[model samples]
Target: MKSLVTAIQQRDGRALQAMSNSVPLQQAQPVREHTAQVFNELFKQLRATFPASMANFKDQEDLNEFKRQWTKAFAENNIRTIDQINAGMKIARQQENPFLPAPGQFIQWCKQGESLAVGLPDEDQLYELYREYCKMRGWREMKWPSNACYWMVTKIYSEMRSKSLTDSEVIKLCAKELRSMTARIKSGETIPAPVKQIPQLYIPTSKERSLEHLASIRKKLNLNPKSI
Candidate 1:
């Protein structure tokens, strides 16, 4: 039991798989239920240990290995309740770096429109550019509020800044690049790889911009009283 907990803590898929395989299956209904519950908690802990991209395995072999280990752990533990299986997982999570952004923080960052650009290419415009880029890559149905999409916009902005391109020129060049990349991918000549690092955008917070806009409106109203 201690070894199994340690395996889970280490995220050792192979060890967990071996331990699970060592356990003999019980035909009892309560035993099956308990095993199922343990499996769920084990998977939840494993999933939480990594980012969504890692959790969602791309290779079939990797996915199968995880599943095999997950099942084996459940059988060996014979854990009856969700809480029992989750206790060790909770402890493991507590040992993780607290300063790292939580899942909610990542989502909040997306909502806040954080970027690495010096100026120009606002959040809305960036989102539109991301949409176009995705469409070019045959992901026309893809939406924003995703790290990948955000990174794409930032990469484009970075390129624009490095080249000192105007907004219009950036748009034109990005469109052309997307088309070329899409063509390569469709032809099986290249793999789709977007920027991995997050970019710093120069855009201000929505609140700050709103206040400035309101101040401008007031100034205009004061200049032309009848326009109010």
Candidate 2:
């Protein structure tokens, strides 16, 4: 009986059936009742939301089988939260596609919805972060308000050091990095989180830019090398 409940929680059908076969009818009744409650509540909401998509489920037996299978799928995929369900529903409404998405598709949509953290700081905030990075020469670290900010500023620091970029060039590159990182985040890629690193304090000499390379960058920025 204990194993039966464990199997039910795991959505392990084979184990559940074997346990139920051994247990008395009264012993399995509670598990059956809970499964029914979840099934009825879960699919009714989905069915009502996308009735057109469920048109193929007109056969009662097939529909019941699908509900059973979907219950397992939801449990396996860890889609148990009200927030996750609502997020998937929200993504469904936003999609340009009129047809209801496949179960796997909806699962990914739920993930994307949850990725939208509240009040991600503006991309322009990278400017300040880049300035902060410029102040240190050793392997120091600091916090960023958002993932996008950390990524953009990291790029800014790397390019500034390796390319021997001027102030104007660094500013332009920082802006470009910010735009690119922000777009990637919007597209549902799990970019790195901005956890503040513990300072290591190791410093290394930076590579010098060739005169020709510096000249080219100045030209791109419409500045003459002779002006400096």
Candidate 3:
């Protein structure tokens, strides 16, 4: 159960649902503890192999075995789930795979608004791989406005970009996300912003400090600062 919640945080719906099913109905708390124990064991095994693909786990013996088997398969197949995740990163020069956004244009803007979302890489070379994943899981698609991608892109840029993102760039992204959101949601749309947590620290005005006020205070106090 705990592992299910953790998977949800990581946005692993399949893992979440599977974890939930593994829990016994009557023994909820005990089942949760067992699940956690199993999850931890599984996590440890996967951590050694396909670290990126390993979702959260509860600490339970049964869960551990499950994780171990999954990890073994992943390792044997050289299926680097983390690499796939990295491929979805926002700042990539490559195009997003057509299969990733799965439902694609069908996903309504009103449904997701402008918010952060995740999907597989858009690389055409991975067409076969994408198709396989889609055939199995149906692309794990979500409907979100550009804001979802913007958040991902900015985060990726921050992590990998040679140059840091400017306030203007971030604002532009925000604006673009808003535009995408509006375009997607028609009137009577109940869609909310994808990233409801307003970017507090990224606002452009926050970067500029007021030196003039400091200078005036220094003059009034008769204290000469070493540098302006």
What TM-score would you give candidate 2 relative to the actual structure? Answer: 0.41
Model 2 ranges off by over 4 Å: 1-39, 117-228
Instruction: Specify the highest-lDDT model's number.
Output: 2
TM per candidate? 0.26, 0.41, 0.17
Which sections of candidate 3 miss by over 4 Å? 1-145, 162-228
Q: For this target, which candidate reaches the highest TM-score against the unseen true structure?
A: 2
Where's the lowest-lDDT run of ten residues in candidate 1?
Answer: 111-120
**What's the lDDT for residue 86 in model 3?**
31
What C-alpha RMSD separates each model from the true structure?
Answer: 22.5, 15.3, 20.3
For each candidate, the alpha-carbon lDDT, in order, equals 0.53, 0.66, 0.41
TM-score of 1: 0.26
Model 1 misplaced stretches (Cα beyond 4 Å):
1-30, 97-228
- lDDT string, candidate 1, 153-214, tens digits: 65676676688877677667554444444334335553444444344568989999987787
For candidate 3, lDDT tens digit of each residue in 56-158? Answer: 4445775557556644443343333332223223222132432222112212221222222322122221223323333443234434323334343434344
Error of 1 at 169 (Å): 74
Q: With candidate 2 superimposed using the best TM-score fit, by how many Å does residue 168's alpha carbon deviate from the native?
A: 35
